[model samples]
Target: MNTFKDDTLGSIFFQVMRLHHIRSHTLMGMQKIHRGQPPILGLLWDKDGRTQKEISEELHLQPATVTVMLQRMEKSGLIERRSDSEDLRISRVYLTDKGKQIKDNVEEAIKRLEDECFDGFTIEEKLLLRRFFIHMRDNLLKVSEYKEI
Candidate 1:
């Protein structure tokens, strides 16, 4: 029998499984938010009022994709877009009353999903894991920026 310590393939498979498990739970939690609402809610959670372009940049999504999502969200009464006071050419997105009402529910769902993800971790372990992930993200960002230059 192959020992785990000697199985690089098993380690890689375990990492993939962990990633997929987190992603699946996250998607399921997002699905609970009213249809056509996740991205708008996520943006609003970060900043209640922002331009569509700003949202796209913050979320690392394309402006065109954000526009289409916003249009759908607006049609569904989850968001409203108004001309920017300082820039008439720019449209700022804001959550509607209905959208605000669902914010708590969405937040709760996310919290639950996180709890599920970190079910067995100690508080210190969780903090350490978060630090490691953040460091990895920063390292990758540096690599990407270097490649762009």
Candidate 2:
């Protein structure tokens, strides 16, 4: 079996997550969607007409980061931002028809990637892995404030 150069748990975890991120980016790229845009799109999917601030808070992203993503998405015709009628200063984001249409494609791409990732894992193993991940997240949460990517 091939061994990693650094066999420490932290190193191995980083390597695994890095590889996973690359694969996910590739899959999302195939759909012409950047990896960062999916989370925002997901929020808009669940509930349309959300403000930039709402998206930023919900996704744990900085306001500037969300703004950049929204700008790109608007240019791609995936979403549109309009001034809220009641509050002209607030801009509410809404998914365009193209954005609504790409939901299936995005989901399928994610499903395919997940299927490949868990190819050899059994149901019990998958459940155990999920629990481990949750525990790891909890551990991090107990420490200083952690920002998710």
Per the 3 Å backbone cut-off, how many clashing residue pairs does candidate 1 have?
Answer: 0
The local distance difference test score of each candidate is 0.73, 0.92
User: TM-scores across all candidates?
Assistant: 0.69, 0.93
The CA lDDT at 44 in model 1 is 88
Candidate 2 lDDT over 1-149, as tens digits, reads: 34368888988998889889999999999999998888989999999999999999898878999989999999999999999999999999999999999999999998999999899999999999999998898888778476552
Angstrom error at residue 29, model 1: 6.4
lDDT of 1 at 35: 36
* Ten residues in sequence with the least summed lDDT for candidate 2: 140-149
Give the residue spans of candidate 2 off by over 4 A.
1-3, 146-149
Tens-digit lDDT track for model 1 on 69-124?
88878887888989989889988888888888777776666677677678999999
Looking at candidate 2, what is the lDDT of residue 74?
Answer: 97
